[model samples]
Target: MRATIKDIAKRVGVSSSLVSLYLNNRPLAARIAESTKRKIDAAVKELNYAPSATARALRKGKSKTLGLVVADLCSDYSSFFAQTLLDECSRYGYQLLIGITHYDPEEEKRVLANLIARQTDGIFYALRLFPADFLKSLNLQNYPILQLSSAAPEFQSMELAREEALKQCAGKLYEYGCRKVVVAHESWANILEKELEAYGIKIVGGRYATTSDDFPYLNDTPPDAVASDSSIYARLLRARCRELGIPMPYLCYSYSLPSDFIDDPRVIAVTVSDYKTRLSGIVSRMIRMLENPKEPVAHLKEPVRLMSLDELREYRCAQLKDPYYEPFRIRIKYEGN
Candidate 1:
């Protein structure tokens, strides 16, 4: 059986209250007598006693766990974000719980409520669709909410400057001699279609945000290149083209990590909106809010750049020592490395 604080108290001939005061309560540690603290410590070591995390969290009203509610994890870009966020959470000794909604409103609501019930310290919301006073609507007003969007009255947010990103997509595709593009997401496709029309590139077709197996557009003559907000869509398109014995077009998608797809010759480029910086930046704000409940609402915006295959290859070869991307040694060309 696992030893508990009561066992330690019994071993030391002291009250479990005093043992808990020294073990879980930090501010009150000073209140414990030096002799009592030493007795508790020795008893803990001798009995191998451990405090229950759930009990302590309930007492303190903090689980030290943050929730990331995202649309889908199948996408490479979203997966990277989750991985980076997990790393960030671990740095501060906090746990991360991800809830995948798959763009379903009912599923989104259920997952959110479940996260809150688990006593998540805060929630980092990445969905574009917002319901005003959503927390209040669910009777979860006291919970803190953060968003990947612009300034909002109720919650803190970190926005992405997507106008320039969309423009870069069209301009790069146009430069690549692409005249028509099929996008992955619907709402985003609507905005991107308008932007592409500005560059004389037409958006031929689009699909739902989460998942769509039927991409008849690729089965046909195929557009110049398939542009996607998520790399998963590009991957799906590639699979469909292969199954139908059709050639895949020059593909463009969003993914900052270049090393993951450098070998794909058909890929035209990937957009990098400084994903690493945005995640770490927002994580900092999340930490502040978790530590200080009264922290004011904060808002921010970031940029995006479309990096062509050549630029990505250059970035890979140079491989500078970066805090975000760890630098490593590569072999000389003579060894067939």
Candidate 2:
């Protein structure tokens, strides 16, 4: 059985009230001699007692746990972000409890409510779609609520400048001499689409609403080169491209992508240093803000590029300049020795 103050008091022949006062560092009865304090300390050591977590929490309001919720756990990016956040929570002397909402409004509400009931000190929410009532229900007036990737207002956010991220991808794609570039994805913000179009790159992929037949961009057979929203889709596309005889295409990816995907002969991915070092830049900054709300915090944003098969062979060391866009290279690799 775990030792408690009562055990110590019983062994020392003193009231538990006196033991509590000494343990809490409260001023003892003025007449209580220092000898009494020494005796209590000796009894505590002999009893080998450790305070309960419930007792510690009752004393300090915080349980030293942070709750994190993500829209979906299936995405590669979400998995990467969760690991990063977990590591950051450990660094801050806090435990992390994660929940997946799968972008469901009802699920998010239920998960968050459970976390609150458990007294999580703070919350980190990463959702693709923000339900209308989510913010209304959250009593964040006193708590520090952080949005890891989204820019919702109810919570402070850690975001990469969306335009800048897209621009980096576009500029690099242009570098590899892609005469005919077809950019496709499930869906992206209208503002981002316009920016990609401005680069003279064709936005071939249909929007989330477009049916396969309407646009037929990439044609399910895959294009010469492709950049996807996630690495899983990228590899799926790569395999499909091989089956269709579409030459191994140069690809652009995010930091969330793994190295194994890039190492394939048919794929040469841009390696962003952020993936290896300080991958938790977002979570780390969020935790720092929680530690010091008034210290003038800033978002952590950096870029990393991956090169695919065609890029690796064509521009292994090729340096070129572009007048219209950033002087970048679409690094690539070759497939089928």
Candidate 3:
């Protein structure tokens, strides 16, 4: 049987109320003598006493639970974000409940309704779709919402610093002597075409097929380098290069590269937005809002960095050897000497 506050109090020859006060760090606890406090601590250690979270929630009339909604839990980006938020919530004495929407707007609505029904203190949305109309219709006065990767004027958000990251990437490509570059996604190509034009590096091809079957055209005309917003497109580019019996060109990735690409020396560089730091800030801000409902809503932007694949490989290898190893500090590379 689990030990209770009464059991620890009895063992320490103190009253249950006194034990409760000390455990909860109440104002009265400060008045207790040092020796008495030490005795109570020793008794708690001996009994292996743990406070009941459910009981405390009932007394306080607040459920210490956080709801996290993701587009897809299977994706590496979502998985990493979810795990980081889960750890942060656990540290703050809150439990996390996850909901996966698979990029469906209706499913997202259902998930949000369920979380609200369950009385989650706050909701963290990491979904792909940002339906402004739906968000505006919801009554969010009671439960605060925070978004990642996307933005909505209705709630607080931690958005990716995309423009700066693109500038850094274009600078790196220019420094590497890339005269012509092929960008994979049309949306990013449109943005980057303009960004790289100033550097005199022409965009040879703005759109390319991501699948193996539609990539034969790359064999006939290969550019100096390839840039992509998605790691999926980057992977396809490398695969197409291999299939054509041609050397892979210098590759620049916008987001986190796939795990398979980390060890492949063909991938020269990648741009990564610091998700851990961004999520930490989000969780802290959400907790503050939950504690004080009158707190002003704010927006946050996470900085992105350009790093070499070789450096990432070394860092990942070291981390794999030691489970307690801290995340490797990113060394940002610039264009000029």
Candidate 4:
């Protein structure tokens, strides 16, 4: 059995109340001599007794724990988001429980059910797609849930504005002379990728994008273009580029590329915002709303913030570019256009 203050007091032949005061670093009355405090400390060290959080939380009637759920753990962005949520929750003296559902709706439902069963104080779920009846059921339960990166059927969520962000990225790529770029992405993600295509992007791997037997990458034949569904498939396409010796430069739409892969000069990776930074922002806003707990959820619908690739690149270029000009004297031109 784990030792408690009672056990420590029994071992030290002192009152449990005195032991508690000594253990909590509170000043005991002058009647309790310093020598007696040393005995209690020695007993505690010998027994390796630790305070119980379960007891404390039960007494306080607050669990002080937060649950975080993510759709796919394999994605860099999802993994980073999980870590960030934990860090953000820590600032509020909250413990975090994490759940991974691997992008399956049934699995996601199961994971959420498990977290709820564990009695987490709140939940933050990142989903690929929201399920039907998700919001209605939650509204019935009156649960505190935050959604990220997935659309909930009737449940409102904050997610990266993928379409808007990618459109800006694609436009920047077009400006940078990447006309024949291919955006290899999941089939369901094609809708999001199409936002860029609508802005005159001729991506090679989008829907209606073709494959050819005449291509050097295909040793034998070609097949009709089908949407990709996994990062492995995306890597296969990159490998095909290697096999064909196609020197086309590309930027990944998602934070699926590993750090090692991003180091490749041919690839320009877009860094998603730090999960902890974004979550901290969200939690701060939520805390502010809690000050006026009576406010409707509609009043709390401040847009979730996301960083754009164009903004990231521009920041990076500004940092890399020299601000001071060399001492070169140029003659002034008098002609006005």
| Model 4 Cα lDDT, one tens digit per residue, 45-81 | 9999998886777557657787788756665445555
Residue-by-residue lDDT tens digits, candidate 1, 68-136: 999898754577689889989999888899999988898988888899888888889887535666667
Q: How many clashes in each structure?
A: 0, 23, 0, 0
RMSD per candidate (Å) reads 4.7, 8.1, 8.0, 10.6
Candidate 2 residues 1-337, lDDT tens each? Answer: 8999999889888899988888877766544678987898898788788878756874687788888887776654566567767776788788888888876778988888787777887778666425646655766545666765565554566654445555666666566654344444443334345665666665544433222223244456444445554555555656665666766667654433332244455443443334423446655665666677665434444553444445543333332232211112222223322
Q: Which consecutive 10 residues in model 1 have the weakest lDDT in total? A: 327-336
Taking all chains together, each candidate's TM-score versus the true structure is: 0.76, 0.68, 0.68, 0.59
Worst 10 residues of 4 by lDDT: 324-333
Flag the better candidate by TM-score, 3 or 4: 3
Q: Which should have the higher lDDT, number 2 or number 3?
A: 3
Give the clash total for candidate 2: 23
Instruction: Arrange candidates, best lDDT first.
Output: 1, 3, 2, 4
lDDT of 3 at 91: 95
Pairs clashing within candidate 3: none
Question: What local lDDT does model 2 show for residue 248?
Answer: 60
Q: Write the per-residue lDDT of candidate 3 for residues 246-305, one digit (tens) a residue.
A: 888888876542243334665667777644456678899788878788766667777777
- How does model 4 fare in lDDT? 0.54
Highest-scoring model, TM-score: 1
The list of candidate 1 runs beyond 4 A from truth reads 11-14, 18-42, 52-61, 71-80, 100-105, 128-134, 140-142, 149-153, 175-177, 206-212, 259-269, 291-296, 318-337
